[model samples]
Target: MVNLGDLNNDIPFDVLSRLPTKYMPKLKCVSKGWNRLISDPTFMKVQSQKREQLSGFFFQQKYQWCYDDITTISYIPVEKQDAELHKTVFNFLPEHVVVLASCNGLLCCRSCFPFHDSCLYICNPLSNEWLRLKWDEPNKENSFALAFDPCQDPIATPTNFKLIRVKQFETDKEALCFSFEIYSSDKGAWRKSEEICKCNNNLYKNRGIFTEGVLHWLTDGDEVLTFNVENELSWLVSVPIPANEFRSIPESCIGDSDGRLHYILVSEYGLQVWFLEDYFESRWSLKLCKTLEEMEEEHSQFLYNLRERVTQRLAVDMEPWIDPLAFKDGPLFCFTIATFHAHFSILEENLCSKFLTSCTQTSSLLHGKAIHAKFIKGSIPHSLYLQNHILNMYVKCGDLINGHKLFDEMPERNVVSWSAMVSGFTQHRFYNEALSLFVYMLRDGTSRPNEFTFVSVLQACSLHESLALAYQVYAVVLRLGFGSNVFLVNAFLTALMRHGEKEEAFEVFEKCLNKDIVTWNVMLSGYLESSCLELPKFWVQMNNEGVKPDCFTFASVLTGLASLGELNMGLQAHGQIVKSGHGGEICVGNSLVDMYIKSQRLFDGLKEKEEMAVQKKQAEVRPVGTLVQF
Candidate 1:
């Protein structure tokens, strides 16, 4: 290799800009002259342009091993003749990591395991830099899309980005409308956009395709929901043809090519690509409509090799398989027989019901009803096990009418069936119905209440602040020898406290056998709710018990400190929260802000009154519907 330093200044900018970005760190170590050349502002701009022009695609492959599933990302370049796929595996990421959207070179991901709508991270795998963002918006029925403009500066380092989340709020009359919350990196906070758009609740799987300065969603109908990232406005554009005129839109998908919007349709003929030739005119030009026969003829050799490889993998069960999706990258998209088999099995004998139950997570009542009709008409047998699952599906899909109807129709009911109905009722805020069902189940005496049953009933009690009923439930728990059960006791304490029975709540908390972190959090939340000034003592006891403080613990303590206007205690707690790596949490940050504005040293009583007014205004600006409910 030629000496980089000797030719550094003389080297053509084109050649230097064409080099991969990963090589920059290594080249910077060659010599000072080379380092200066690579780091130059002009050279950086050229490099950023080259990087943007480079064609590549990113996708994830999931493999299930026993009970655990691992997802690996692959990046494939289109221009290179023989490019090796770049793989990224983040071990620290949650088991159920979902790629929400990609903007520039940064991937926006959310961790869905252990907790849904838990945390989001914006990461650049090339730079190995990532930041966890506190998502303070209500994530219910929400769709998140990431948009970044790199017109001036294309390098995917820390820069200004706007993350848009659209959430659907359904009215009692079944009318669907949406509200938006936009998170600006500049603001370092999420703001509720005043724009609310009316639309059908037919979003395609929490995914949106970003193109040209807007994010687009292909609904079940002919309408394309478009949200302008810059202006924070949303509008619907009609498709050239009605969705029903062609194949089912549910099976179709929307994507982006270059900077224009594209709709992909997979039909019996083959893959047809439609490009939007004019955004305002809503004119679409047919790009490619390759027949399956032509595709098969072209990919015959590759298909043969793929078949051989899949056969070998199935024979040994040790050989790894890869399913490449190079849709927008180039014409290298490939799928293996193993993938087909995994998908085809979804309609098989035993798996179809399970798939229906899993689809409940989508909260699509219409889809659930369709599947229910299929189950009734299909080859699947109608067993009690399947009935319980159907009941659960209806409940989870928010179809309580059908859920109750099916529950009452069950000729032979078990504990699972009753628990499913009760839990569903409790989840939908049907507290009276849930409690009445629990009582009915007990009076029947055939199916006994399980842990889930007790938890659901306790939630209902807590909702209505039913202290007398809570005591009665506690008596039943004691008689059933479940008084020592940590889960039941925790729920009981929550119910008691919500009913203003603070003394009884503490008595129950102290009588608990094994106090876990959740137990402590419940007690802390109870104390904070009651305005009890014994949090300091409780912290001492918690430390004595060797239980480390978690985010919830710190949030509760901070709430207490803020309430009392104890700036010293608040400062100490804030220090611990930052040290514990929860400083970025929205709740914690809000508490700190309240504590600061209320600090006795910072403001006199009159000043405090003024600050409180300002704080209240800020708080009013942040509506409850904007943040994750949990």
Candidate 2:
């Protein structure tokens, strides 16, 4: 994207691209020649990606435009070293501006002017990479957000991503869609995302988020739209929002934390959050933060619940550091400043000893046992009796070195120790190291491996792409017993598919009588990603086995069919999809449309797309869908 800039912007893009599209709307605001340039699709795409990256990262209400001396600002999450939160500086110098949205760790900012054209930029403050995107004319009123299109599964990386600015007309009744663009690193041109803007006669805000290859936002009328970068299609979705929230709060923006879509609804008193759950019939659950009036009761409840989690996390009666639930859901990104700093400080305090010493120790280290005796020798067995108290402490304090040291010194090892070691490795992505230890425990008389061990080993094998060892470990599991355990079997399937063994993988799966949805997904992915000779047969087998092919089953099978260019067989599957009512799922519909398009069935593709459109409208327009209110 950086290769060619418009003749106006002194960027390398103009000089680099075979044919550059430049000096569009922003230049058009300057002259008619520039306006003509803005009309081209290529220019729109590049500028949009760039703008999306910079135009929105994170913005707090700088309520007033106070373009005055803004000196010495340290970001909250970063400056305080909040473990779960993110912090980065604004790359551009202390020039005052307001941030709109941030996508893919890039931020966009607007200057102090009320009506004039505001500046746009894509910046990674941590990396100090900044690209300034210019816009044409004044943006007096616009409903937009910064969106990064990292096509998770790319057919091919498009020329660029886009910044979608929903331009409202005189009244809220209509809106026009314009985009600021980014240049694709892989594709050397600007690309366009043909997203349509939704209009309503009510106040709207931009809560656009970059997730799953789309930019999603709740519209002014409380509807949702998702923009797909690969196909450049803007699709409407029915985002769940609570009825009371819209009535109580004037407007809100969208944000994602910990893989869940969240909308921050602020009122006179404080901020409330609605967590959008995509599963369980697409509903939003509300969580209220504690205010002064509610603090005592909430605090009492929190402590009551916290005590239970601590006991579960810690086993023995040692003082609990972090509540066990805090680590549940795999470390939430929600914590106050004081709580986070305390957590970090606790980590540092625990790291002062030999356990800390081992972690930062070079790969070629000496006296492994000597180090263990040096820091935590005598008091450990007592610590172990304390229900893995010290282990939890080590895990929490981020003192894995000490945790491992304590772990190794134990008189007898339990399932938790091995699991912890494996988990630590998995978390850090040292898959081979984790798998080696898992094997060592199973075969080398170090520790007794359990079902959890098998799960961890299979997962590590998947990550390492260790097909040979994965099969061997599968054998070990069968010999050790618990071969038919569904969870372990699912992990085995996942590992096999990851290692590219689909047929034998299915053979292994057939032995596991207890079937679950996850197991089916792994089996299905083999057919989805690669054409195994037996996929059509397996698709039929999955149905015979009383395993209803969900949208995922159809999606994966369709992929294998598409790869083989089996249009006739593909049509047969499509007929099954219709009979099975799988066409209603958004995921299945998307895959179906793509398959149809590839098979030169535009009519079918359009028909599936229309179903998605209908689903979106029905979900978003009105929960009850009636013109009159009782």
Cα error, candidate 2, residue 365 (Å): 27
Q: Which ten residues in a row have the lowest lDDT in candidate 2?
A: 621-630
Write down the TM-score of every candidate: 0.47, 0.39
What TM-score does model 2 achieve against the real structure? 0.39
| Candidate 1: clashing pairs of residues | 137-626, 137-627, 137-628, 138-626, 138-627
Model 2 lDDT tens row, 57-105 = 1213122224432222224222122232222355353445556656655
lDDT of each: 0.67, 0.54
Residues 477-538, candidate 1: write the lDDT tens digits: 89988888899988998887776677877888888888778888988888888875887778
| Displacement of the residue 507 alpha carbon in candidate 2, Å | 3.1
Kindly give the number of clashing pairs for every candidate.
5, 40
